[model samples]
Target: MSDFMTRVLRRETHSPRSGWSVVAAILVALAAIYALLESVLAALGQPAWLVHPLDALTWIADLPGPYPQILLGAAGFLMALVGLIFLGNGLLPGRRPRHVIDNPRVAIVVDDEVIASALAKCARVAAGVTREQVMVVVSARLVQVNVRPTSGIRLSEQKIQAAVESQLADMELDPRPAVTVKLASSGVIGV
Candidate 1:
């Protein structure tokens, strides 16, 4: 692939994974600052800011029998869980809720909300219903359209489905999403 295509594909599909790292860094910095403050207070013969380091170490060492064992086990488990969470976030690709529009010259990515809104509009027009009567959800693999017909009026499911499908075709979305249209059992009074 060309450089332009590669850049566009990377920018559109994936989000930055540095958020967790930033949070971890901030926590570590805060802990370091607290430790420094405690050390300074101890050296000056002043009361410790929190627990003195020596006292904390002595308490851990003096803890009796099964109590220490249980505490250590729980601490280990908590650390392992935190490590796994960070590892998973770092390793997995952060994909956005977006669809790609393929063009020979340039890449275009559209947010799912934009696609849903467009399909909702199409369904509303096809069903002859107001905006509130139609709800559309566009996801990576599916476009679901739910419509409530105007009370006392009949609606055609096939017609609405066809309109939505036609609109999807016009969008030329890459990895085309499946379309499903459902009419609600009860209708709202027509506005």
Candidate 2:
């Protein structure tokens, strides 16, 4: 693929900006506005909304001097913890747990759940089992197929794994995942 197409595919497959970042931004903006309003009120010799800016500054300046050192330390630690959490959310790459299919004409980004459903369908057909009998879970690097065979019917784990692998190969997923098939020890009664 061309450079532009590659970039577009990468962006499309990855997740968007973190919601926590947006929330943090909104909260900061609100706090700033409140502080500005309080400052203006204090300058005008009017009643403050929450606390006068000067009084607030004084409280912060006092810090651990008069207050219990443990309490002040805990408050500071909590604030630092929240700031770190927000910073991490902003800096971290939020990649979606999705698979990308390379197509010559179009970029295809598939959700893990959709991939799992497709695998389940393929497993059901290969094993001649009902929908409920086959369960597929798709992860970034693994595809797990769990099958409960009908009573008196012997199931081949290799066959199911091979079928799931074949379907995955056909999809041409980027960073193709490994496949594993697990059969339950006890089978359910066939309807």
Most accurate candidate by TM-score: 2
TM-score of each: 0.75, 0.84
Candidate 2 structure quality by residue, lDDT tens digits, 1-191: 78888898788766666578689789999999999999899999999989999899998797767788889889999999999887877787766888889788887889999999999999999999999999988887889899999999998888888888999999999979999999999999999
Measured with C-alpha atoms, the lDDT of residue 56 in candidate 1 is: 77
Q: How accurate is candidate 1 locally (lDDT)?
A: 0.89
State the displacement of the C-alpha of residue 105, model 2, in Å, after optimal TM-score superposition. 3.6
Model 2 CA deviation exceeding 4 Å by range? 65-78
Whole-model Cα lDDT per candidate? 0.89, 0.89
How close to the true structure is residue 67 of candidate 2, measured as C-alpha lDDT? 83
Regions of model 1 farther than 4 Å from truth: 1-3, 39-47, 60-88
Pick out the ten consecutive residues of candidate 2 with the lowest summed lDDT: 12-21
Q: What's every prediction's RMSD, in angstroms?
A: 3.7, 2.5
